[model samples]
Target: MENTNTLTEYLTERQKFVNDEITNLIKQMDAPLQLKDSMLYSMEAGGKRLRPILMMASCESYGGNYKSVMTIAVALEMIHTYSLIHDDLPAMDDDNFRRGKPTNHRKFDEATAILAGDGLLTHSFTVISEDNQLTSDQKVFLIQELANASGPTGMVAGQILDIEGEKVETSLEDLEEIHLLKTGQLIKFAIVSGAYIGGASTHQLESINDFAYYLGLIFQVQDDILDVSGDQELMGKPVGSDENNFKSTYPKLLGLEGAIEQKEKYVQKAKEALKSAGIKNSLLEELTDYLSNRDY
Candidate 1:
């Protein structure tokens, strides 16, 4: 019971921290007239803020301060939200719903949505690049990390693979390859970027990277399961989406029980990585467990 109480408090506190930063970043944007409303529409929609939270969690886990990484973390979420907005556009996923409400294109016009997504994408780099404390070397790394994770060789490649996989029968290996890039890259960036910006030691970065790598894959596995089992009211999107779209998933590749087993294995791997670091981050450990078991 005490353990449960501790985990609950950690989650609530972390949520508060990221939630505040997200609001501030959106409010302070110097957006153009044509794109402002649509950009704000999705930015303020209140998704999980998982990436930014992971940045803080991982930074703190490595004995680094979370506050120092807040702006960069917010920048990560903005880039992620921008991708989702564009992915929902007619030319992409054509998703009409997000967070149980109208997507950007649904709330605003298509051109506006396009420009808004574009604005967010461009501005994400600007925010990180313009930060005064980040040395040119650090800023360069941040830009590279953000671009590679969200760009052609990373998430975009994964997305393209997903789109291509639709045209033909897919193998389990194919699905893993797609998601490793598609979802995992950005997540990996979130976990490690915090350490990079915090000036973590080389060994610390390696350990943190290992923890995040498995955490990221397991995170996606849980999502595939949630999209199958989660309530639309709770998930803010329809359930059984992977099945609905005929998209192959971990649950499909390895049965539901098998996928759970895989997720646990990765979670264990993540925990073990932290163990070698000889750190006591009860919050970070519990967060890994939460990601392993989360329903949405």
Candidate 2:
């Protein structure tokens, strides 16, 4: 209960901070009214705020100011939201429910949704580019980092392989490789990008990246489990969507018991990486456990 409250308080402040700053940025934009509203609508939808929280937490763990990390944290969330908007398209996951509401394509027209996703994607870079607090060197490095993490060599490539996997038989190793790229890459970026922006030592960056790899994989594994067994209100979508879509998953390869075991492997690895970092935050440690054990 104590752990939960601490995590909740930290996250609540971060979410509100990210939301306000991003809202101010959107309001200042000179886009068409409808397009701007559509983008705002998608942004307003509630989410776990996981990526931003991770970014902030990563920075704090490195002795960097969480307030200073907020903009990058918001940028990561925007990038994440953009990916989600596109991924839920009719051609992709076709998801109607996200965070207990209609997916972007359902809330707005498909064209609007696509444009909003594009807007968020490009606007995220604008935030990065226009950030005045970061040194020019830091800004350039972050730009390169964001492009790689969310670009073809990263998240997009993973999505391509995921789509391909759906249409054919995917070996277990191949599926892991695909997910490591698709989902894991951004997660890794979510953590280590903060490290880079914070100027963490190489050893520290390596530890954070190692932690992110397991964190990312464990997150996806938990998603697979939730899609199988979670309630509609909690999950905000139909269960068993993976089976319906024929997406390759840990459960598909390893069966229920085996899959649980596999998730623990990644979870343990994530915790081990955190321990090696020698940080002393109970909340960060418990967050790893929560990620692995959570139902929604």
How does residue 67 of candidate 1 score in lDDT? 85
Local accuracy of candidate 2 as per-residue lDDT tens digits, 12-97: 77788788877888888999998998888888887777888777777767766667767777788788889999999998888888
Give me the runs in candidate 1 sitting further than 4 Å from their true place. 1-5, 278-280
Q: lDDT of model 1 at residue 125? A: 90
Please report the candidate that would top TM-score against the real structure. 2
Tens digit of lDDT per residue, candidate 1, span 144-213?
Answer: 9899999999988998898888777788778878888888888889978977766677887788778877
Candidate 1 has which clashing residue pairs, if any?
Answer: none
- Which 10 successive residues of model 2 have the least lDDT summed? 1-10
Which numbered prediction scores highest in lDDT against the true structure? 2
